[model samples]
Target chain A: MGCERYRKYVGAFADGELEVKENLEFLEHVKMCPACAARVDEVATMKGVLQRVYAKVEPSESLRQRVAESLGDASADYRHRPRSGWSVQLRRLVVPVAMAAALIFAVVIWPSVDRFRPRPGSVTVVTGRIVSDVRAQHTACLGRSGGTHQAADLPLDVVGISNVLSRELKLRVLAPDLRSLGFRLVGADRCGVRGHSGAHVLYQALKKDAYLSIFTVGRLPEVVTTSNAQIFDVFVSDGGPLAVLGWHSDKASYLVCGDLPKSELLGLADQIRFADADTQDPTEPVFVRRDGD
Target chain B: MGTETGQGNEDARTRFERVAMPHFDVVLRMARVLGTGEAEAEDLVQETFTRAFSAFDRFELRTYGARPWLLRILHNVFYTMRTRAKRRPTLLDDVDFDHFADELDEHASEPVSADSVDWDQFDGEIKTVVAALQPEYRTVLLLWALEGLSYKEIAEICGCALGTVMSRLYRARQLVGRALRNYASQRKLNVERFN
Candidate 1:
């Protein structure tokens, strides 16, 4: 066959779409043909580069929330219920109004309060600490002897495990269903973040040595809200070697941190179900407050 | 029974969330490619989900995952909107591929090294080149090359035959490759002239 016919198979071969017989034929042709080999390599490399570049375009969190809301009754299990039409209208107006108010504040209230001006990137103070603490716990625990446990040692079921931990820790612990995402709860430990008591749950990938740590703190001063505000006030940051995805509700704050990509960590965060601490007895005592008022 | 109905709804929602929602990023990426701008892409994605949710009952979870199905809906939504606005559908024959192929062959000997390429600039240039292609070619190429869909899957998403997918992809790659070669050669020439 001429080079043109073999050229037609180049893409299919690179994509591994060709039949076994045709794939072997294409490989044989390329061995003798440097130009065809170069072309194949170029196409394959371009495919890789394109995937890397284009896959970086993440959809905004607002868009995710908008789609979830549009699902209406279909997505009833979604944590954030859709707002009523009037509330939606109010929200639409609130953003622009708030922007206008901020503009006015900057213009009128600025000159005298230069000292109080918020520092750039300082908004993620609480989130940064949470990420750092999670990374620290992950390292410390992974380093300590007899720190990790097997699945057989603890409750294997996510909900069962969370229930046990919640009872033991006297806090509403969330055990996200990560089985579908190919992760299993390996163990749990008593860990504290910034001197505040919390639970650090460890998970191991079913087929890999990848580990993820989920740290829950009962109370932290809400420092800031990051990009995704629709579901929960959440922030995502890179913790040196690991990526951290953390979110907060009025009752508790949770962070899922791992060496995985930010997107993967975020996916795990989305699956987490924060226990409704509201339903628990009020006198049972929630997160440990800081010493002395 | 009430309990049975609740279970069914739960199952459907779970399936949709797992199968359909996971592809949100890629769908949005394709939406940006298909739509005119960010706002249009957002609208396209919204409409795609709305339609997909409505049609979720027909989505057979056991047969296939949701990426291709969602992509088909996105493509249909984009083209339908374009048609309603009286815009011309970009046809494959709109571009002269013979010349593109010739240009590509001329630069075949001067293979560009992967490391030598400025990926950021190359990414932007490729995006422009892709956006300029006919919609038919663009869809096939994006599905096959970028999204890593199989030719058969691309055929299914595109509502075409496998052979058609192969032919369009070949031509699309040639066009993109030629454009990249031209851009690289021009950059090299400018650098030489300046120095």
Candidate 2:
């Protein structure tokens, strides 16, 4: 068949959406045609890169708190039964009485207004400390290596290490696959931030001489900011030689500190997956579905 | 009756927290892509959850997951806000592949070697190109490429036919590819001029 007829199928073929017979034919044609092969390659690369760019964002803790408060109000309102005329009139007076009490309480507490208000943009102080600690640990690891060192003699493979950490920390530990991104696992170790026990997993890029250290903290403070088209609330600390990106889920918090750009670090962060906290056994290996599976 | 109502509300809240709230980041991500900016996206997400909660009684987990359902609410909220503000989104439909095919061939034949191109520069360029795409095209592209939604799920979230989702994604890729090739060519021209 002419290239024109096969052009439309190229996208579906790259997406792995073509029928079995058509997919076979499409692959056969691409092997013989460089232009068609290039088209497929371009599509595949774009898909992979874009997926990396779309890192999962951790919504700010404030939002979650707000939602919970709103839901509480909603449930309270639902609990109120319909009332007769006298009760309705009493309910109307209750609003004004409540407002009066609130006014009095506010006046009494007005002296401590300065203490109550958080400084502008300083809401993420706790998150900042966690990220800083992770960055410091990563720097320490680099200094310990002294440019190059043999991989640490760890007793566990990636899964075994995850199980051990998950059990010890009492939080699910996710070991993301980085082989496709050209990084191989080095080793794992026990680490902590602010007395919270956790695990630190190290990886080195296969091609580039770059290193990545992922620190999983059991108790992490919520800190996040929104930027540009990216949706994830990834707290990026990029002042030093290494860039640190931190985020958290309901179960555990994570920090990926490395000598990489913010975008690349965020991409690596997205690849980390945790097993369901209630269903999966901490001692069992967590399964991560690969791309194009 | 009062106890029953309270139990129902509690159940609804529990289901929402478990099913809907977990997908907040996904909804927020889609909102940022679909809305004007971060603040606007955050507002849209807030409104989406508010509306979704009010209508939570109708939500069923059997047919579709919470992500798609939440996304549908987000899209509705975004468009409704746009409509109320009298801001009609400009839909770009010029899907001419022939023009891009020649460019692709020329660009692919004499491909810029990996060593020659600065990866950071390329990454920034790709982001810029994607951000510059028309909203209609960008939404479908993001839903498919970034969110990893299948065509069927995209159709459900987008409230369109599966074929429409496929075509929009194809066109979006073509546009992005064309923009990328143009960027590379511009860089090449600049390098030659300097040399």
Candidate 3:
């Protein structure tokens, strides 16, 4: 079965609802698939762990009383209070009578609050001890680099590296391909881009450990392109320990990061460059490979 | 038989007051296991009683008995409340068990033998570890473990599909296993640290 098809069956397999034949088939597949086996194991472990973790949670005595009392109060209120119809009539007559009388004495007053305005999206900054620890680690890395490299863990700064890189490469580039992956933008900052002398820009994802950092240098020290390569070429290559993909268009260069296989990265880079050629800015500097020097 | 019925009702009320009331603390403890905290747990028990008493008319003393009935009400009320709103992810959030795979990299590769394990200690830890599950998982396991409800009754009470209840129970058991393994490792680490 395909992965999504297998995913649907995982719940059933966990329930032992599969027929003997199907169960054997599923288990056979599981034997060959370590990732799926690990997932099943984790799901099982997570369920049991959650049970024990919540085993002793007692509502506070006061909250218990409050809920009970609230229930009692609602019952009493319902019994005693007039239902909505009668109350509505009473409020209408009384309020109108009051408002009519007050209208003569009422001064025309301007309201302080704005009404019918579209509300802006609220930005929430989540600060946690974990983020603090990461920040501290970043500071330590910066110190190790003799303050020349401001090693920071913020995601947005990594994204911003694309802009710096775009400027240097004289081509339009954007960090964090939002459409391809549903990654949220995190904070960004300037850091020593790994190989370049000048500061490298960085951007990051809000949740995951994924980051995009680019070194911005003025021009590729040498114009190097293979025969098959055009203004923009996307290729996935083994980036030593990490898998890397580099894409170039006439305008700018983009590099995506992950432990992804070289073929996948290169394919993605090529596809992106082909699709987004005209939309990108030409002045943005294309990214030069660090090893090229 | 009518006389006997009246007598049975009287006895049921009296028994409920005594036997079930004393089980208040235990029931509360179980309620927590089922995902309600101290206050909500108490309300759960109160609601359990209110429903149990009101439905006392329908309950057959000869059939399934009071414990299961009371637990059924508790489980029903818990899932009802839980389903009404988005539940806050409980305390055990971000505790991914996958990280335990990294511990294999540590020294001391001695594998523990099954014979070396103490059943009593293991059982006790199992209880505690099960106690430590996130509220969502804990609730179903509690209905199974503490109340001894069958998967069918658990599904009915939890208002989930039978498979979901069974899956949850199985998963809950697996988590208990992981917790036991984690506890054993932590204890070993403590011993090593002290040494």
Candidate 4:
């Protein structure tokens, strides 16, 4: 018990922390006890060493500037904006007293600007995927017949098509171009026109809200050859002003559907040619399912 | 942007610059032992003033002038940052404490009076030794010897119990004594690790 007391108070003696009377008493104890005295001495030495070292280090210059800048920036943040007393008083009274005035203003001009402007392609990752998917579908269709055309309405199926294309080919293409041009990708199921089982890729990216569909030929029938003049004439010639561009390769034919003037379709088709066969997979791909239309 | 509000903020800023910027050198010196560079110390001091001025609306000048309040703010700011960046690297940690002890012993044996100890050299040696202490002990000694803070005031600032404060102060004093004695023993007498 006495040793415990000494150990607890030893740091105090080393520090000169006791009252004068207590200091004298501790000094007497130290004079008689070697172990306590040594402990006290070591603590005192550490204290002195620290004090001297603490005294010498001064602040450097640039650190001062950065801290000031940080403080100034914090003060200027929008949440801290200062306001006059009168403004606070005015807000308190005006907000409660003028509800009727506020309601009418909100109703008179709210609907038009709030109209749905689709934001599907806003995200960069989605935008890149949308472009790649559209390009690949167009090129693959051009591979089978000398031409191809949408033989059905497939908005319901287009959602499924988006899933299939993303699953099999992993594309994130969007066809909102149909909506702007007054058309939409609307419908589902398989169709055989000119002996080819063509799946419809549809969209509305033009005026009059037209239902445009591109027929992607999965397997070309043996009958769809150079001699099928009616097939080539209707699909390739600018008939009904329903512009279409189609090409055949070793596997299939890809047709882009739209009421896009024949000149524009030809130009778009020329641009599609073939999806770069060597495009690497995305570093990260997010899985998405099309549920509600 | 209100005229009255703008004027009030501007006034506060002006007061801070006049009263606070002048004492930057002293505050920086205090901060260095607390593990700050010249620039960071100055910044800590500046931030201390900015906080004080913003709360000046409640300040009671009758009880205290801006100095003690500003210094307390400065101390709080330094320690708060130190705690937050708990592992921030420090240069003094790179020093070899054992080799430094040897040098102090060699110099202690010379037949020299306290005045004969070169002030600049002594200052340098003392600084190195102080920097070697842990923050807990260093704070106690510096607040007492250099900042002249009373034990009660240090207890309040450090948020420690009175007994704890006293013990820290005691340990601080002992360390200083030992360092000085070690220096003294080196001058002529060979001393063991402890008497």
Candidate 5:
């Protein structure tokens, strides 16, 4: 079950269904396993092909109207049968009362907006802090690189760096394959923001003075919503030459910052399979390789 | 007195059109894919809407919006119609999706190399293989890949276990992925021979 063990995840990863942390383990496994690596590449490519080929058929306007017509007046039961008596009197006052409420909320409360802000330790606040940290680090790290070769922690061995980051940050990470977008994984190191440990993996583009970095923390706060939220919903912020994007999957949250246009950063983000992984892979490793030149 | 009733009906129609009509395309799209060929797709959509309209009073606006609610109704309607049309009791619940997946797994062919096959040319083969899938496998695949619904949402819509949704989806993709690779490889061979 060597390949089989990772097969299910390969499918989910292709679909971008794995949690952020779960994605790390799959990424790590794929690096070492040649067969699984090819399998993932194949599956991901096939998904794109299938999506393009699958019939995106829609009902004709005539068919839709006919269906609506068939529903008949019986759907009248859907609405509250036009309430009368006291409800009519109540309806008349609703507009003025709503206006009064809106006016009061704006004048009395909008100024003290800090009170309504996500309390510290909340998912939004923590996520915001993580994004800021990644942004600051993206700036600071590039200044430190200062015409140096990709060395130290992010040595020639990428699999080792992924493992080291996963081991140090206590969450698994692969330096991610961004070469297709003309960026190479330069190196990785562990960093933290306010006690939140993170894997800070850096990428340098073919274009001079261009850099991209990914900061992932396993300390993802549970986002409680009224219902299921989409996993691929990327949270974007801070535009200009540099932009930061945040997204979550499983138990990890990712903050990606790049010194490029928002459009370019977004294009790069599309290349990453955002998901979570605990990075505690208790398996034999294989196929040592390098990511960037 | 009659005017009030007319006004009420108009209000209801407007509300139905607002809340439900917007989702007609998705429901119809899924129904067409789930139905045999395209002829009865409209019939399926009609019955689904009919059922949904009758039960519309029960539908409260939920957090995920009207799409999932509308889709759940469509899912139930599609399976129910298939059972009735076949004059058989192949209830959606009766089939063990896990066992069904196990069967597909046993027969799935080895995957062709990702680099060797240019999938862009095999659009017809992709359509053919997907259409050839069993209805259950097709439903899971379409809902996941085409519809972009989450596993939990799919489970809710299909009225099956979450594990079963995962099982069916995995098996469905495995079959699709294998078939596409095979088709692409076969196409490459044909092109080579002609050349």
Candidate 6:
């Protein structure tokens, strides 16, 4: 009975799903209790066996080719718009309702027009460095939260219990309430990228293997404005998961980077708007109305 | 050609390849187990991907990525295939899993006095033990063990409640644990005979 409570967590502990604090707590109990420790070992060992034995059950090259060929031969996709639009009268009739529907979707998804359109024109070294810094910061945050690395090094209050952004960055940065998009604000961190006093609010997808970081750099990192300065670049060598969207208003530069699909990241970028520093509330991160909202 | 509609078409293919294509092998392996035969399974996976590609624009990226969406589509395809063949009725969903869940979990909860037997010794027979499991149990177990998906992700793939995934996982692990324990015991007996 004494060990039964601990035994239920034996699986999660072995799976490494328990948060660092919870893992440390369980580790303390397991050291004194051989029963829980043994259970962990048993479950971990069996899981290893199952994975090792069944991992060989994989698809062959031919199946891959067949699937690829099928995709190639598949009929027109959902975007296969008809060559003809409605008559001009029908277009005028439907335009208002279409705009209303667009407004409804505008709360989250973007029609990709001013979204993450990549403009590599006038690319400067500073712009590239900002992207790299944002990616590194996202990877570092994921590492700390991933339960494998730096668990012991993290402060106990690192996971959303406190907000150091207001005190540390002293910038008008809105973390942008992302809960509607299935991500919970994990925590915030102060970062130094190329001598820029920057900060990022980390958002982990609720029960998913993805993380998003909304980074706001002081002084906008020298990325001159060009067609909204919303250049979205993804280095394929990074295995394509490190897609990042960087944009700048008149002052501060912001980069939204994540391991999520690029469309979602762009949708998040649409929500990131900034207010004039003097007019904005200094004590609180400001969320200005998006253009045409 | 430079119209918004044309651009949307280009983006659809690019996004689908980036998001959905990476999960091809994972879905294929799952299809093999879900379908009765390898050729049929390959056909099913191809059809699933074809459908996914056709509807890629509508597939939204939520808490999880394209993997869950692709898996959900694959399962739907498999179910339709089974329904056509009339082989889907033996799914074991009608069985009183609650009674068996408690019974098996009770036995498994009291693990066999600490797994002293060598796991490598039973590696050959382990696949058999897992294969003997019911489809629902095997599917959940393999998703967790091989794919390394979280319970929530698995629940999304299985289209079941989170608690349902937990109970199914518990039952799956319980059954596999019992088999491993029996193998350990038999291995112990064989060692005793040699000694």
Clashes of each: 0, 1, 55, 72, 11, 0
Worst 10 residues of 5 chain B by lDDT: B186-195
Residue A46 shift from truth in candidate 6, angstroms:
2.6
Q: List model 4 lDDT by residue over B88-118, tens digit each.
A: 3343222232222222222222232343444
Order of the predicted models by lDDT, top scorer first: 1, 2, 5, 6, 4, 3
TM-score, one value per model:
0.53, 0.53, 0.32, 0.39, 0.55, 0.51
* Candidate 5 segments exceeding 4 Å error: A16-24, A76-245, A250-293, B1-12, B87-121, B188-195
Docking class of 3: incorrect
Candidate 3 lDDT over A1-293, as tens digits, reads: 53433543443454334444555566567656654554454333333333334344444566457544544443444344444788767876898798876664454332223343221211111123243443343334443433354444333532244434333322223343432232344444343323433333333334534443332332121212331344232233333423333443332344443333444345445444533332222122122111110
Across A1-293, the per-residue lDDT of candidate 4 in tens digits comes to: 24334455555444334444554565556656655665554443343334444444444556557556655654454226756799889977887768767676579655654565322222111111232344343334343333343433444533344333322221121211222123345443343345544555544333332233555543232313442332233244323544345553322345555444555555444333222110111111111212212
lDDT values for all models? 0.60, 0.59, 0.45, 0.47, 0.56, 0.56
Residue A191, candidate 3: Cα error in Å is 76
| Candidate number with greatest DockQ | 5
Which run of 10 residues does model 5 chain A get worst, by summed lDDT? Answer: A278-287
Per-residue lDDT tens digits of candidate 6, residues A51-127? 55655455688877877777666634344545455554687778889989889777666656546654222111111
- lDDT per residue (tens digit) for residues B38-92 in model 2: 8888888888887788777677433446666778888778888998999978865
Measured over the true interface residues after superposition, the C-alpha RMSD of each candidate is: 11.7, 7.5, 20.5, 18.9, 10.8, 10.3
- Per-residue accuracy of model 5 over A134-164 as CA lDDT, tens digit each: 4465545333323122233444333445434
CAPRI-style class, candidate 6: acceptable
CA lDDT of B50 in candidate 1?
Answer: 78
Q: Which order, best to worst by TM-score? A: 5, 2, 1, 6, 4, 3
Chain B, TM-score, each prediction?
Answer: 0.81, 0.82, 0.58, 0.69, 0.77, 0.75
- Native A-B interface contacts kept, per candidate: 0.33, 0.27, 0.02, 0.16, 0.33, 0.37
Worst lDDT window (10 residues) for model 1 chain A? A120-129
Instruction: Indicate the DockQ of the complex predicted as candidate 4.
Output: 0.07
Error of 4 at B127 (Å): 1.0
The A-chain TM-scores of all the candidates are 0.33, 0.35, 0.30, 0.28, 0.36, 0.34
Better of 3 and 4 by DockQ: 4
